[model samples]
Target: MQDFTRRATFGLGAAALAGRAFAQTAPPGGIPRAETPPFAVTPEPGASLRIIRPARFVEPDETIFRANAQRFQDKFNVPVRVDFVGWEDIRPQTAVVANTGTGPDVVIGWSDDPHIYAEKVVELSDVAEYLGKRYGGWAFLAEKYGKRHNTETWIGIPIGGNMGPCVYRASAVKEAGFERIPEDHDGFLKLCLAMKKNNKPIGFALGNAVGDGNAFAQWLLWSHGAYLVDEEGKVAINSKETVEALQYLQALYPAFAAGTLSWLDPSNNRAFSAQEIFLTSNGVSLYFTLKNDPGTRAIAEDTQHALMPKGRATVAPQTSTVMNAMVFRHTRYPKAAKAFLAFMMESEQYEPWMQGSLGYWAHPLKAYAASTVWTADPKNTVFRDAMENRFWSGYRGPISQASGAVAADYVLVQMCAAVASGQATPEAAAREAERRAKRYYRNT
Candidate 1:
């Protein structure tokens, strides 16, 4: 609201994408400054490529996708066919296509398998280096997804990402507060606890939705000041940070609405509609939910979001970052496919296509992120803010996906069942999670 990003620095490491969160304030320069790459690139004339995207994304307008297709074709003397697919189907289907020699050159789907170094997708190291040479390089991919900063090999690019945020009723918080809403995790959780004592719902409901359960684990990771992985690629979730995070959740459960375990994203929306809860942490879908429901729309008119409260240790899972577009190994048009992939990651076609599709994806290209043209849209600003400070859960590397039964295995799901139902002590649940995650850590 108050030029949020301009004043804040995000990523915790150097040469890491997180650092890009802060605007570079010029030092009393009577001298003019150089332009940022994201803001400066021009479409390559006679430069075009073919790209296949997830079908779920809204296709381009009669004007943009088609005209651009022709423009790239005419300019680069290549054809760009834009295809779509349901995200779930894109991977296996793409794999089959790749295996059968019929897959698309580029894919648009969720998750980035960084550990799978030689898999179908491209590692961004070469591209990151190229961008570094041409334009200033920020760790576009490094700091993404809570990964240790500045190591090499990025599997996915962030197109549009969602952050774990506490979307709350502004009016409700003003009603509960001692003046000035707190952004610290402990303070906010305390408020949630107090609200519950008064029989007020804290807006948390994850029933029937693995996503809410999924989000709960992530918020816990952030609050605990622990990470899923350590710098050495070893799993670290069983440590102090994770246990502390579990305690935080256990402490807050009593204050959540009565049927919280049954709460999903919709439950929170329902509570918001009924004016029953004060806050809940979740992704951008909360905005979509607000727009779709009539009663919620009224509540939406007053709802506000903040980055999920920062723990003493700063962390948040990169939800929806690391979009992968791979060149199928058995493709008929291998060279074209590779070209298309390179181009897709390039900003020229990337920006307009996603924007035209009404896909609220953030720019995956490091250069595109610096664009004033891209950030000029206010709808994009909060996203821009979320990107710098946030990260995706480091998904399994491209060679193989994590065997994480995320919906069922996610720690939050277990915590809610344990703490909310009074089945176990918070400490007990934390110990159990550590045990389960240790197995996953070994395998992953």
Candidate 2:
């Protein structure tokens, strides 16, 4: 899911566009053209986005995010236009665009942070349910998860998704003398100890920067049978399960690549790429790590991906679909905007989205998931099976907004840094994290 190796699947299958799925009318690497009757949406014909990026993607295919406005316009029979801006000027220039409300028909690619949720993004509950029922009721998962959110609003919908429990080279684990993947929390720790004796870092990202750590930590904490919030919607990181997961990681840290504290997306990715670390509890970014990079791809080629080893924590990964898309309150054409949003949440729209985002997003609409196509696709359906009664919109806590999330990535990193650097004890770090979480929830 990191910027570097995640393939371009959204616009994939368009003729020869670098890496995306082929849509019906796609001309070799091209965007899918709308098959519906050419129904033009006339919104006074004024929509645009600063054709700029803060950190532009290296691949030329990345340009399609902006380049394809014409397709959206043609399909909707609207006169929407794409405005050009270099990355350097994009952010500052947004003030003028946003303030004037003369921006693009829909924003492209810059969604992250709670601002997207709180401000005006599309909510797909109705669409999710529609797609779910149409696709065989798997669409219900979206509304089930999205409904009654802490925010009293459905924030976003995921177009594609996958979760990795714990990834270890099967051979590496057996070489370390474990017969199979650990079945519980303690077994995982023992496996780590064994690997440490042989000098291998238990390969989960711990740098508390952003995406990587929160996701990794969530899987571990859930496996260990704990979470950031208690049953009372209060901070619970100090619970037994939390402590066990915390110490397990701390004890296993030294066996990992040196200076892991300084690690984030790239450095830790490099370690995994080089086969310097094994047994990372992470998502499927390993696909790229193993396939793309020249250095690590060789070893990664032989690695086996496995379900996250179960812990005393048996819960499924919490769905991020709760907050990826939102509808604008000020949308000039609410019906048309809603229609587009509706299309996005449906199984058909998501099929393309899943391939495009490289599965970084999961379908928030359960309706879309029930599609035979989704259930049948090897890559798309694995997580669907795991989602049975396992998914959560977000932590069931006082924090009302799904966007008001304190990702496990940041929490785990700060905790590890404390103990690894001798800056704090595991217990102390846990307590501080709890205190901070409590404050965050209360304020939110």
List TM-score per model, in order.
Answer: 0.65, 0.71
Looking at model 1, report the run of 10 residues with the lowest lDDT sum. Answer: 1-10
Residue-level lDDT of model 1, residues 99-137, one tens digit each, is: 565545555554443233236554544444444444344
Regions of candidate 2 where Cα sits further than 4 Å from its true position: 1-21, 25-70, 78-126, 138-141, 148-153, 292-301, 315-323, 330-336, 345-349, 352-362, 365-394, 402-405
What would the per-residue lDDT of candidate 2 be over residues 30-53, giving only the tens digit for each residue?
222234332233334443212222
- Model 2 earns a TM-score of 0.71
| C-alpha lDDT of candidate 2 relative to the true structure | 0.49
- Model 1 segments beyond 4 Å from truth? 1-105, 114-117, 120-155, 178-181, 194-200, 204-213, 257-278, 288-298, 314-320, 345-348, 353-359, 369-380, 390-428
RMSD of each: 10.1, 6.3
RMSD of 1: 10.1
Computed on alpha carbons, the lDDT of every model, listed in order, comes to 0.49, 0.49
